[model samples]
Target: MHALFKHLRQVRDGGQRREYSRYLAQRMGPMIHALMLVGALAYLVAVIAGTLVRHSPLPLWLRLAPLPLLLLIAASTRRVRQPGLLSTLTLLCVALLEIGINLNGADDLHRQSVVLPGLLLPVASSVIWLGRWDFIAAMLLCALGPLPMLLSGNIDSALVFQYLVYMAIAIVLSTVLRAFMARTLFEQFRLERQLREQANTDGLTGLLVRNRFLELARSALAELHRQRQPACMLFVDADRFKQLNDQYGHAAGDAALVALAATLRRQTRAGDLIGRIGGEEFAMLLPGNSLEQGCRRAEQLRLSMHEIRRPDGPLTTSIGVACSQRCRDDIQTLLARADQAMRQAKNTGRDRVVCSPDDC
Candidate 1:
């Protein structure tokens, strides 16, 4: 039951449905086709047994009718791109074909019993693959399946009522099961997304964590190296962060850091990557930028930080700029150079930007 619900959830999830459809096309479709072929062969065997042993007068055409339908199902399964649609259509075809066969054998009590149970196949298929609307369609088709027997005057009122009760039970079960599976999948996806965000982002600042930022920076550096394009790293530090904590409190320092993070975000371009690398230290990666351009950007960030007002006073930052041309393609080497430049800014006086030694 658990395995079946998992399959249903895979088919139902909008994000995964397309891939699941392709999987159905490659794997499940062939399995279903094989099952249909086996059913067709079984029908042939049943016809032979009925003729030889029971002396049943079943028409050869009636027995052969399912073959063409089975072939159509195989063709449709192979051609359909959507799994839910394919399953719904296939189940409808199977239900209709079963109904027609049952109509042909309406006079035989044993055959009627065998064929009546086939109506549940669509309900089961719907539960396994169909979303809400498609499941409703499958249920409607299942409800209409026994209509031909009633119209033909082959089935009595009591038998009709019995079939209705059976269908009602199947519908309730399928609906409940599908709803449960959908809820389970939704919760699972939501939890996974939350966990991923928590893992990648800093808890307080809502910026990429040090490790995640480093990973992205390395990737950007590799791309820049391949393209032979220049990139820059800015290592920024709050100029008097320790003083703020000493004067006010840790809370005030934290608020100032959050504000600084927001200012950095506002100052950087869409392509630029920014993260808090340590207490009072932040890093930004500027792709396709030269040393001069990086210095200007860092100055802009430094000025922006100087404008941010706190309860104690205005906050300020020192920024160090290092270009890929001077530091090579290594992230650590580039950051180290940038860190040295940042220290130069801090030493000369706070709230300024300094370039790497080679650039200076």
Candidate 2:
């Protein structure tokens, strides 16, 4: 039961919901068209047969009156790309068929409304309805659609019971099928997300790589510019990282890098972007942060580096902070200023924070 709930939980995420719905709409367009075609044809055949073979007393034209309306609805189904809209149109089609069947039977109360479209529709439609609510709606309509006609005909209680039981079984089978498909699509979406993240992030630290960081940072900065908000960039370097690697080993160096990445991740906001720009070098882009705030953040981050333990010494990093308002608007210029300040920090002392000099 928990697993079933988990499978259905994919739509809980706003992004996943949008993605799944769009995918569902694209896949369901042709399917909806097919279902509409089938429904229209079946209704047409049932109407004609009732008039000719069953001796339905209603005028053939009155009995077949809904055909044009049905065809119009079917034509509209060709381009519908919204799930809710598609469901509404489908339910409309189903209801039209049910009404048509009811009209066919109005001539004689003994006519079986429980047959034809009602018997087959709910179960048949179970496969195409991607949403649980949509499926339930269709099922209820199919199950109860023929009740008035059936009861008016002096139908046996046993037969109604049999129909209800068959409906229950069909619903269960369709529900299982829906659950299976949701699980499959959800898994596919998750795998695709993982692949995309892997491609964009560093293998060891899981921070954005240099190229991905630059690509996203430019967009973030553009938004900041539009908002007229100050932005800050930080260039962080492990002090004496080469010496530590030489003394400790590449494995130890890798561990230190991972630890630094984790610390950066813990300290930053979700909107802040961190990237492993180079070996022993990382960068952060803080949108809407002023120079003072960036400096303070850098100092706090430098102090936090005091916690990560090592054999010879605690981990220490030199962080350079540069504000967009102080530097040129270009990211490259911001990066260069931040890099210069970082070098200044490294030169003045090993582990410290430095804010870039104003470019303006």
Candidate 3:
């Protein structure tokens, strides 16, 4: 049983470093399932071995007598699905099995020897599956399992007692070790998740970075095409940004960018993809929006920007709107058209909205 518990921890730790919770769950979930299956299979094999040894001439049945109890313990574990509960139950079942084996075989020397190792199984189960209290429960059972041998003189009383005491120490030590390993694995998982978030997010706008933004946009584009769904993109560039940076310091320029990014975040819907793709340039991908709807949204953003009072007084944006079905399958091509329209808006005058001619 100690060996079985060790096997479980080995499998669980093997996949705990995955970066995403979804991927981590998917990876470890299978290994845990496989561990349970293997434990169950081992129990069945023990039962078969017990049955075959029952007819042996040398009384191997007594040596393998606790095998049925171990089988019962393994079978009980499969019934509980929740991790903490299952672990506790597995430990309790093993402890109870040890008590039963000890009581029934008080006078059989070989049976007593087999039951001593059975005591270790409970300790292992408690360390691997259950919490501290469960570990103590199994440890107490370990103490009890050997006392019958000491009482009946089936084994040297002092030697059996000494071995029992050593097993108790081992159980406590194993439980502590297991807990440390579990904590380390969880910490690694958290760090990996944080690293992934840092990689996929932009520092300036706190929005999805360019690569992640494009990946999401491409998927949304594919879905829109399949459903013939309405969708729009608003390509926004801060008007006179280079002049602003030159006249005011770059510090003031950064402040303006931050302010605009905050405004865009507040203005966009929860499902919209608002991303910073380049200096003073951002884009919004809005699903379920047509050209007319996009025009209204872009106008709202334009008015909002004009209303903002920065340290440099105010700043404005030039926006170009492009809706789905206005162009071919390429996202870059669609964005290029939107950029051209934005350039047109800038040429006509800044702080204005322009849409594709098909939209007009």
| Least accurate 10 contiguous residues by lDDT in model 3 | 17-26
- Model 3, runs deviating above 4 Å: 1-21, 55-182, 325-328
When summed lDDT is taken over every stretch of 10 residues in candidate 2, the lowest stretch is: 109-118
Flag clash pairs in model 3.
Answer: none
The C-alpha stretches of model 1 lying farther than 4 A from their native spots are 1-172, 227-229, 325-328, 357-360
Each model's lDDT comes to 0.72, 0.82, 0.66
Clashing pairs in 1: none
The digit string of per-residue lDDT tens for model 1 on 166-202 reads 7788777777777775556445555665798799989
Off by over 4 Å in 2: 1-6, 9-108, 152-159, 325-333, 357-360
Supply candidate 3's per-residue lDDT for 65. 54
Q: Best by lDDT, which number? A: 2
TM-score of every candidate: 0.61, 0.79, 0.63
- Which candidate ranks first by TM-score, i.e. highest? 2
**TM-score of predicted structure 1:** 0.61
lDDT of 3 by residue, 148-205 (tens): 6456645565666566667767676666666665455455666776797799888766
